[model samples]
Target: MTPPRLRPLAAALALLAAAAGVLAAPAPAAAQSAADVAVAREIFIEGSEFAKQGNWDQARERYERSLAIKRAPITLYSLGVAQQQTGLLVEALESFRAFLVEPSAPATKEYEPLARQAVQDLERRVAALEIRLSPGNVAGLAVKLDGVTVPVAALDRPRMINPGTHVVTASARGYREVRRSVSAAPGSRAILVLNLERDGVARPAAGPRAVAPRGLPAGEVAAAEPAAGNLVPIALLVGGLTTFAAGVAVGLVGVVNASDAPTRDGDAADAARAQALAGDLVAGAGLAAAGAGALVLLLGRPPESAPRAPAPRAAVSPLGLTVRF
Candidate 1:
C-alpha cells in the first residue's frame, strides 16, 4: 500500500539510527579498566574540592592529573579556569587549546574570548632570544643560559626566555670557557654569539707588564720563552754533533788508509769510502746547524720599546687642514 520511494527512505533512516546507537554505546566492561576509571574519578573529586576551597594551585595540580588519566573537555575547561584565576596565563591558554580539540566540547562562545586574552597576556610576558654560534661551530660543547642548562639537541633553536639579564656560558673540555652577559626585555629578543678555542699550555713568564683582564693588548704581544725542561733541542744537538764527529773520524781513517796502500785497486776502494764518509759528515753538520738555529729562535727576547705617538692637533682653518712641515 505504501509508495516505493517513501519505504526506501524510511529503511535508510532506520539503518543510520542503528549505526549511531552502536557508535554512542557506553564503554564495555572489558574496555574500561577499573584502575584507570578509579584514578580518573579520584582526580575529578580532588580537583572539585580544591576549586570549591579557592586553592587554585592545588586545583591546577589535580586537574593536570585528570588530564593525564583522561582528556575530558569538562576537566580541561575547569583546569583552564583554575589556571587563569592563579595568574598562570600560559597554562590556561594551553588547557583551553586542549579543550577545543574535543568534538563535543561545550560553551564555545563563553571560553573563546578568555582563551584569546590569556594568549595575548602570555605573549607579552615571554621574550625571544637569538643564540648564534660563531664560525657555526657547535661540536662537543654545552651551552647554558640563566642557570638553566640547555640541551645540546636544542642548539641553534630560538628560545623564549624570561625577561631579565641572564648569564650565558659555553663550555667544553680542552677548550677555554666562553661567557658573556645578556639582557632581555619583555616581548623582545637579544642575540648572543660565542666562539671558543683550544687552550694551550701557558708559556714561561715574560718581563713584568700591565695586566689587563683578558691578558695584554695586541701591541703588547710578549715573546713566549721556552721552558728549561724542554729536552728536544738538546737531544737533537747531541745527536747531530755525535754523527758529525763520527763521520769525520771515519773519513780521516779512510784517507790515511788510501794514502798508505801500495796497490792502485785498493787505493781506489779506500778513496771511495773516504768520499762517502765526508758526504755523511756534511749532511750531519747541516742538521746540527738547523737544530741550533731553532733553539735560538725559540729562546729569543722581544724588543722593549714603546711605539705609540701623541695625537696630532687640529688646525683652525676653514678647510680643517693641518700644515705639516
Candidate 2:
C-alpha cells in the first residue's frame, strides 16, 4: 500500500528495526549472566538518555557502572564519549584506548576508527610529569601519586596525567616525607624534585639545645651556645674534680703525719713519716686531676649537630579537569 517514492524509506526503517532487534539480544561474546545483562542494559540506556540531555557527568557515571558490570566494547566506546563531553580528556583517552584494545568482534568492528581518532586528538592535549629524588637509590624510598603507591621501577618514567593539579609524595624510612603540588597545563611538562633530609636534620635545632631561646636579642641568642648539657664533659669534669679532692685530702694527712723512716718500720715515728709521704703523693695526684678537669672544661669541643633547614610542604586536592580537545 506504500507509494513508489516511499518504498526506499520503508526499507530503511525495516533495516533499522532489525538492527535494534539484533542488539536487544546480548552478543554471544558478552558472556554476561542474565542478571548482569539486565543491569548493564538498564544502566546503558540511562547513560544514553543522559548523553542526549548533555548531562555528561551523569552519563559518564552510568557508563562507568555499566562497564564495571560487563566489559563490553560498545560500553567502553560510549563511556569514552561521555568522558570527552565531561572535560576529562585523559580519562576519555584511556577509555578509548581500552575500547580499541578489547578483543575485536564483528559487532565492534565499525567503531574502531573512532577510538583511534580520539586517542590521536587527546594525545596532544594532556600533560606529562616526571618525579625523581636527588639520590634515586636512597634506601627505603617510596613514592605515591595521589596517595597510591608508585613502584620504584616506574619512578624514572613520565606519567601522563590530566591537565590540573596533582599531589606527589616521596618518603623513606630514616628521612622525612616530601610532599609537593604541581600545576600542569595542556601540552606542558612539569618536573618535581624532592630533596629529602634525614629526619632530625630537616628542621633547625629548635629543641632545648637551640643556640638561642626565642625572643632574646639576636646577638645574645647567637652567643648562647649552651647544650641541654653534654654528658661527656660533665663526666670528665666530675671525675677529675673528685680525684683531685681525694688526692688533696690524702696529701693533707701526709703533711699532718711525721712518719718518714722506712716501709718496714714498725715504730710510731716511722709510721708517721710513711703516712706523711703517702699524703704528699696523694696531694700531687689531686692537683693533677684538678688541672686536667679545668683544661677539659675550657678546651673541649662543644656538641656537633647536623645543620637543619625548614621543610617545604604542599597538599594537592582534587581539581576539576580543564576541558581540552
Candidate 3:
C-alpha cells in the first residue's frame, strides 16, 4: 500500500522524459551523397546561367534536372516561374502543383498564388472559341485544342487552352470535312460544334420540267410519285399482301365449318374458333388493303414537272388551221 502510488507516478515521469528527449534530438542528415550534391550544383549553375540569358527553354531543362536529383521546392517554383515567362502556361501549372506537394517547403505561399494565376490565364485562353456541330452528330469525332487532340469524352468539360488563334477540324468517313478558325483570349473558354454532311456523289440536276414550281409537296404527292420506288417498299407490300390472303382463306374456312353445326357442344367450340379466325382474317385484310394502297400510290403518280417556256405563237392560215412556229 505504501509504494503502489509512487510506482505509477515514477513510470509516468519516465515516459514523459523519454518523449522530451526524442523531441529534442536532432533530425537525421539527408541521404544525399557527394555525387548527388555535385550533380545538383552543376544543374543549378547551368539553370542560373540560362535564366540570366533569358533562355527559358534551356533554363527549364536545367532546373528540371536539378529537381530530378532531389526534390527542391524552391528550385521547382523557380522553374515554374521561368516557364510562365516563356508562355508555357500548362507546363508551369504542372511544375507549381508539384512544388506545392512538398509540405515542408517554405515557398508554398508564393507558389500557390502564382499557380492560381497560371490556371486562370489558361482558362481564359480556352474560353474564346465557339464550336457548333451539324446533323447533331458526335460519333467518332475528335476535337483538338491548340493542336492537341482532345478526347471526345472530355469535350463536356473545360480544358486548358493556349492563347491565340486555333484551327479546328472535324473528320469522319462518309461525311464532309469541316474546318473552323477560332480565337482564344488569355484565361477564357471557347465552345465549338461541328456539323457534318453526308459525302456522296452529287445528284444530277433534273430538267426544268421535272422541277416543282410551287410550295412543299403534299404527302399524297410524295407517295404517288414513282421516284419513291425502291426494292424495300416493294418487298414489304408483297409480303403484306401474301399474309393477308392466307389469313382470309383461313377465316373463310373456319366460318364455313362453323355454319354447318352438328351437336350443341361441338357447335360452340367450332363457333369460337371460327370467330377467332375471322378476327385474324379481318386484320390481315386491312393489312393487305394498306399494302395495295401504298404500292398503287407509289407507282401511279407522275413527278411534278418544272414550268416550261411558252411556245412561240404560230401564224394563222386562211383555212383556220394554225401553222407551227
Candidate 4:
C-alpha cells in the first residue's frame, strides 16, 4: 500500500534500483566485501517492500540495518521518509540532511530538492533542548527523556527532540529519582535540568571556590606560616652595636690621652697624636656599622597580601644577604 504522498515519486524506485546496481559494481579501491554488499542489497529490497506496505517502523529498521552493513545512500532518503511517517521529526531532519551532504549519482541529484524540503518541514516540527547541570562530578548518573534513555555523552549539549510533553528523569545509585515534566515547543530551545539529590534530600547548588587574601589555596590558607626573617638583620645589629660601644670606649681613652699630652714631651705628644688618629678611624667604622644595621632593619618587612599573585618568588638583594619575597 503506497503512501498517497509518495505515489508521485514512483519513478524514483527505478532510479534507486539502477543506483544500487551501480553501487554493487566492484571498485578498484575502497570497495566493500561481496558478502556485505549482498546483505545490504537484500535488506534494502526488504525495506522498500516494507515501505510500500506502509510499515514505516519495519521499513526504518530495515533501512538502518542495510546502511549499517554498507552505507547505501538511497536508504538515507527512504529512512528519512519512514522516519517522517513515524513522527520522528528530529531523526527525519537528520536523515534528510545526511542525504543532501552525501555524494550520490547524478540520478539521485533530482531528489535533492525533495530532501531539502523534507528538512525544512521537519525543522519546524522538531524541538531542541539546552541541557544544564550544577557544578560537580555527575559521572554515572543516568538521564531519560520520556522513558527513552539518553546517552551520557549527549548530556549538557543542545540536541533536537520530538515536540511533546516529556517526563525528564535522572537517577543514580544513591540518589532519588528526579523527575520533571516539560512541554517542548517546536523550533524552540527549552532548558532541561536534571538535578539528582541524595536519597530523599535535595542538594543545593555549589558556589564558587573560596580564596584567601594570601595567595594560598583553601587547604593551605590556615596551614601557611607567617614569614620568618633571616638572621642577617640580627647579626648586623649585634655587630654594629658592639663595634659602636668599643669605638666609644677607645675614643674616650684617646681623648684623655690627647688632653693630658705635655708640650715639652715630643715623644708623648707624637704618641698622643697616633692614639687620636686611631680613635677617629675606629669611631668612623662604628658609625658605618651602625648605619648598615639601621638600613637593613628599616628596609626589611614581611610581605603584604597578594590575593591573585603566584606564590611570590624569593629574591636576594644585590648585597646577597637580605631575602625579599
Q: Is candidate 2 or candidate 4 better by TM-score?
A: 2
User: Which has the greatest lDDT?
Assistant: 4
In model 4, where do residues sit more than 4 Å from their true spots? 1-15, 27-31, 134-139, 146-154, 172-174, 200-325
TM-score of 4: 0.52
Q: For this target, which candidate reaches the highest TM-score against the unseen true structure?
A: 2
lDDT of 1: 0.59
lDDT of 3 by residue, 107-163 (tens): 235335555565555444433444555654545776666567866666556556557
Candidate 1, 17-84: lDDT as tens digits: 33233323344576646576566656766766666666768977987886676555656666776776
| Global CA lDDT computed for model 4 | 0.69
For candidate 2, what is the lDDT? 0.68
Model 4: number of clashes? 0
Rank the models by TM-score, top first: 2, 4, 1, 3
Model 1 residue 254 lDDT score: 70
- Could you tell me the lDDT of residue 126 within candidate 2? 83
RMSD of each: 25.0, 17.9, 28.1, 20.0
Per-model TM-score, in order, reads 0.43, 0.54, 0.42, 0.52
In model 2, the clashing pairs are: 251-279, 254-276, 258-272, 258-273, 259-272, 259-273, 259-274, 260-273
lDDT tens readout by residue for model 4, 6-55: 44246336535754774576644566788878888788888777767777
Give the range of the ten consecutive residues with the poorest summed lDDT in model 2.
3-12
Taking all chains together, the TM-score of candidate 3 against the true structure is 0.42
